[model samples]
Target: MTSPFDPTPLPPPECPAHASGGAPEPEVSEIGPGGLRRLYGPAHEKDPMGLYEKLRAEHGPVAPVLLNGDVPAWLVLGHSENLHMTRTPSLYSRDSRRWRMLQDGSLDMTNPLAPIFAYQPVCVFADGAEHERQRGAVTDSIARIDHRGVRRFINRFSNRLVNDFCESGQADLVSQFAEHLPMMVMCQIIGMPEEYDEELVQAAREMLKGSEKAIAANEHVMGALYRLVARRRAEPEEDFATWLVEHPAQFTDDEAAHHLRLVLIAAYETTANLIANVLRMVLTDPRFRAQLSGGHMTLPEAVEQTLWDEPPFTTILGRWAAGDSELGGQKIKAGDALIVGIAPANVDPVVRPEPSASMQGNRAHLAFSGGPHECPGQDIGRAIADTGVDALLMRLPDIQLSVEEDELRWRSTLMSRHLIELPVSFAPRPPQEITGPVIPERAGAAARDWQISSPRRPDPAASGTVPQPGPVPAAPRTAPPAATVPAQRRGSAPVRAWRTLVTWWRGY
Candidate 1:
């Protein structure tokens, strides 16, 4: 078997600038163990976030870790700093050379898990207006998309899988339940035919498994897709392939293939890990499993907690500064690579509920990227997970972990974080066909509550004559300091102010 190593360089993560110049270690805190060592096989493969916390308690909260001498990166542990860094557009940037390297095709895909670079460049790699258009194409309905559509799709898919597994009394949740779910759904969403499903899924596995052979297979699929985009241009259909064919002026076939492949992997890879990670979360939290079984928590609620507690896409790769700049209290030079341990930031008590309670069931975090670059396909993911979990649980409420949770294995890949397999068994259920729309799971506006809200005033007891409670007033917003405001011309502010007043007056 190949050695377990990230395909990219593994520089000991940089500690904060405060710890720069061979300074003594800083502080770290301890949360419960995540069983990382036993799963990954090596101590170094253990989660840096966990180690960082240990280091922080031993040192100071603002810890510094030196890797490669000059690499100065710090752990932003507090909620305030994590939020400050994540939302900072001016100081911090999200760019990564890793994607560029992937497409460069220098690596040998001969290793089953080796990654072959792009079939072409995915559009997220592009910045500015071009990215907007590329992203906008699928985002058509975009934010307005009925997340319900996603739920329905997952419900259908999950039922099919559960019906197969629930009866077997045993199934490898990773391969049978989790991994296959995303790949098949990805194929459908990307408009690829079943003809390529098995091979594409197999290829996807290698990339995540980080096997050279799997990597090569993925490259083959990507290459075929590049060619297919051109061929499809001559013959259009109702899928993404046809969409690219029709929008010849907006993107070339090669570009479309490249972009689509990115979208597919983005959809598939994150999810493969998400399913595994969520399962791990459920297994670890007896209360959480009880919540699911007892219906105290709906699928949506459970997903929210898992997303915050242990999102699979722990770190997102981005380039520092597009070049480099001072960010998160560190002076980052241009051309530096950054691995934003985004998931860890999500779990910090500040951003999330105290990790302990949230571990029971709390706020959802941004496994998806935040702000402008946020995953446009989040609705699809939400829909898939909610539907899948709901259907599976409903079908087999008694399902239990076949292997001890600690004994389960985990592996990371070029694109995602995940488990090796999840074996589960339950009393069989009769196969049932899933048809029609799946109900939507409610996810709050952007996955977190930035401010507190008053309880919904309950409707007066239904006297049969009582009308429904009147619409409550919207919550007050946090106002910015006035001094920072630009001076407005004498009449302009009054005029605009009057217009706003009039609009509110009319609504009332």
Candidate 2:
């Protein structure tokens, strides 16, 4: 197996000093303690729409602000500027290693943002040919996934989850259903057994909090991937893990582990929030609810609207300046740290004067970052969210929030904007009989040996954060349909990658 970290030559420099062509230096306004508190503190976390609006209106699209009230970074608040920075990767690099704060040891490695900004062996951190290599491998494997099979998997899991609390007449949808459904779908996609679902859920909990426990959480997830890789190598099966192992990239065992870890977590986090946000919209706004049932808005349209208004991810990790540059008339010096403000950029009044009206059918949001480093799993992520939401709506059409809309809470994190819990109530219904073909049991280790010990769990209460629930033990899962794709063809990675992006563009 070849090392997946193979480096590629850098592209010719597209940005140079004085690239702004004598534009006056824009005052880099620091986001003082009040600003930081307002952005990631409790008030902003609850509903960032107002904060983003204030920032964009007061500071223009691109403004400089202190991260955590100390770390200086530029927040790209406009849609056009966000697109310019991300689309021009040569000008703005994704390589976190290039971040001057990390190099100078000013940034603490233990900082909660480390997981996203710190260097990792996977493609998300890589650039140039290396990015293409790892990205191609991921996109090619993703493109091979049968679309209908993915929908079936989501439906089965969604149905299984809904049955868990249907008799209770009330449940916290976020903890009980919205959160766990995506994790189960991701596990099924990666060929993990059903039994380890609890452990993975716990790992996700730790990973999101991002402290000392984050270190333990990382190890826990990697350990599971290692064991899964060994099992697949010993007994190859029809799953993403197997395809990754046999792909032309020939990723080494460790390389395979890292990439699989990335895929699982990315797939789980993005889709989970996507499903939750869409459901929240469906439950909160009677107008939106009527639109859905009246055929005025489709599930995909709902998903699209959520992506624009409340993208799963609010910010992308720091993209450092390779050389001094200017964006939207703001002079960005070399080595300046820039964070893509997804929430603000998506609603920039300049591009989207009326954000709500623009999203009726728009697909031009930066929820998924653009350029060489765009998310490779977006196609299936959308499928998973759409299918899961569709299943819930079809099953529990009368579901409504049990609590007042204002009473719901959102998690406080620098990188994610997730609802902590969405309590909802619905009329009870009798369980349906299992009539589908006898769903086959999963094939993997029988014991719980893969559950690695970790450091002491973080105190969610100490931080005033609510931990999401573990995966509800799913019933026998319906087997997904076989992949409709043929074996890998020559030079197919680029094609597959292109097809996935194009699909995202046209909303096919």
Candidate 3:
């Protein structure tokens, strides 16, 4: 089932560029079903930045569209032409094999947009010096991490998931705290085994909702990451799947389980849709809840204004071209594909013309995307979304929202916009005194050795409240002890044959 669109031909003697002769076949159309209901309707899932400002005022800075309705491609939408096509990888090339409609097979390799533009072997589907040796073993194992031990392992999995719904004062917070605290701190930084955290967050959330059981949920998360790289090569710990099976880019154990399934599916799909779109802009925007409840916004300025006005990956995948150029003014050819429009280049009125009057001293945002395959663990997905939005604004400091920010809903998909649930409400407090030891959730290997020694979690570099520049240390206290869970697991033999292969692969 390899077709996440594989093409591969632009290497060796660098040959394939042949389409010039009479330079024509470009402007596509077929987008029917009433133009795919005006580009994925429900008003483009509740105003996709007003449909990227009406497709950048009628297709200006590179637009073209279609996908699923016909398949076309090219998107970009300015911001210095998506930073010169993602910092010029020699005229664009994050290898979607080297597309030309999946190299002339004319697309549709079981298209449901084949689990995000197909071809996966990780290091974001390599290119040039094999994308710097699988992105230098993921930026040198995320630069030998420590961001205050990732803000105390995301404040002990955001206070053990807000003490499992903080005594029912109401919650949903996107499936109990922004989709299971970044996939349980990416299965405790890939050492996995907390009895397979809800089967790897339900097989990476139905293989990122491109479902139809997305290729058997991407082979049940690549057979639980090739059995956690064969139990960290027969038991070697200190996580990140034993630092990518003891990396130095010697890979191969299925290339360190495809770069640990590309850093655990890009840390559970773009850090849980960027901490559920900065908690839906701090509970429905009223100017970021009066500048995040008055201390003038900081949780890294509401995650850099939610990565510059709403951006949990607004498309940045396919980028093929590499030959007959022109871009922004159109003509692209050689292989074609493109994309990048990251929410229309972060509101690009010729490069952010007063996008919300320059979001509090802006921090240029392609949302951790740009250049030689950007996002080397975007500062550990912004320290697990600024320590799970500073552990729900320091333990639900009077939370809010139980509905009506125009009654939410969004989640159409063709590259995430997320929020199929947030629901809120607060004023509960009290439950925060657990010092540590609580195991017993079918105590398998004593609950994966108490999530590998109670959040003594480390790996993910840091620095003073996010202006960023590394060298860490000093930040520890991760909460975990209040228990009560039972979805079964008990004893071992590789977690009872990996919980009978995730209950016989979810009985289907």
Candidate 4:
């Protein structure tokens, strides 16, 4: 039932101009894209991005490898393949079967009597209109980083966790702090009852660990979410849960519940890893620390750059091609997996030269993925993580890792770059309200959501123009399409009103 030159429609191409620009297509080892089982061990052990970089260095961006020893997977390191994957949904299916493995019966849950379930996704996993609907509500409900609010939450909870383990001073940052932050914030965003925060987090964490025991334990977590979905269905509130309930055009009860799980799961790892990784990276480089600690620089810019250059999504996402195709002139057969190399794609030398450039530019990093299939909740994801960083740095500015940086252990996974644990000495930042310490850095709607940068290239996947690793780009392409700003934006309305009132008072 398969033909090498079958009738499946090929994807629409971007400007093929850049395909001929810089370097010749990299070389690959496997005789054909189908012979990827040979490249499994190193690729699996080193994370997809690391393995992809090696292949790109030797083979090319379109290096084909095998997934889990049998299935063929394409390593789409080149801009064209990356963009093409996003654009052509017909050739790829995001419906991942790996998620179902979480439901294996060997694991047991706190709610042993609970119903068995399936792996669900937010709009990011959806195609066309359904995906769009989920995307719309998701884009709306992302909680912003309010310095005051996040500060309060971090202080109230983190201090307790630290205090509980202070004398010992060796609590796993993954469980104690990094994991707890996102769990708590997600609860807050969803308007879950405060009493259930710990209970809910425990369940969610169970699902997160992805083990047989953890899977079974996740029943409680999924059950609580199920109950909450029903409650919101009856009486919707203003929080994300309520919005999800009201957005009938976007998702159903089942869809919303799955999305809720996806959001929490997605939000949890990235936030934890970003914060913990920044600590590791900074601690590793004392000069960077001196620059940050000595007031020469704030960690935000450094944090943004580090995220761009060395993203936590070392092995974050994977895709399965729906049809046979050619990317960068390389063969890609149907039933092949295509994992996005966010870290490599970000630091491709072609994407951003300095890698440390501030966000004061266009959305440049593949760290968030691109095209319609891009991570819809990244803004919210960044906001939550940024809040944690802001909280940690602002509340515990002088915090130092308890162990030597060299002794720090890193975990090997297909998804992210993370330390096993980050034990630190917590110290609060000196309280001095500087003038405009945190500015939006936006000249327009899309003026770098994470940093302050301008748009330079419309199709960044292939566009040669890029910022020179600075805070802001000198020649960003142009403004993006006009999107209606949400009035419910956390601090946007208050900030505007407060400024206007002050100006009026001054005039009077």
lDDT of 4 by residue, 430-503 (tens): 23332211222212233322222322313324543322222432322222112221111222234344333322
Q: For model 3, how many clashes?
A: 9
Better of 1 and 3 by TM-score: 1
Candidate 3 clash pair list: 4-118, 4-119, 7-97, 145-460, 146-460, 146-461, 147-460, 147-461, 147-462
Query: What lDDT does model 1 reach?
Result: 0.51
Q: In model 2, what are the clashing residue pairs, if there are any?
A: none
RMSD, every candidate, angstroms:
17.8, 15.2, 19.9, 15.6
lDDT of each: 0.51, 0.69, 0.66, 0.53
Tens-place lDDT per residue, model 2, 381-470, is 898887777666656656778889888877856667888898887788766443332133555433121121122223534654322222
If scored against the real structure, what TM-score would every candidate get? 0.67, 0.79, 0.33, 0.66
In candidate 4, residue 484 scores what lDDT? Answer: 26
- The digit string of per-residue lDDT tens for model 1 on 1-508 reads 1111123432233425224356655432222122111112223244555654554354332233322222223434444454555565444444334333233432322322223222224555545566566666645423322343334455566776777666678888788878778876666545454434567777866655554375487677778677667656664433455454444135766667766777777777777677767766665667675654443555567777777765767655443344344544445544444444565566554555565664435444657856566787876775566556545654665667888878887664322456788887777657875553222222232211111122222332433221222323342333211111111112223434433432232221
Q: 90-160 in candidate 3: lDDT tens per residue?
A: 77887788778776676645555666778877767677788887787777666655544445556666877
Task: Report the lDDT of model 4 for residue 480.
Answer: 19
- lDDT: the better of candidates 3 and 4: 3
- Ranked by lDDT, the better of candidates 1 and 2 is 2
lDDT of 4 at 237: 47
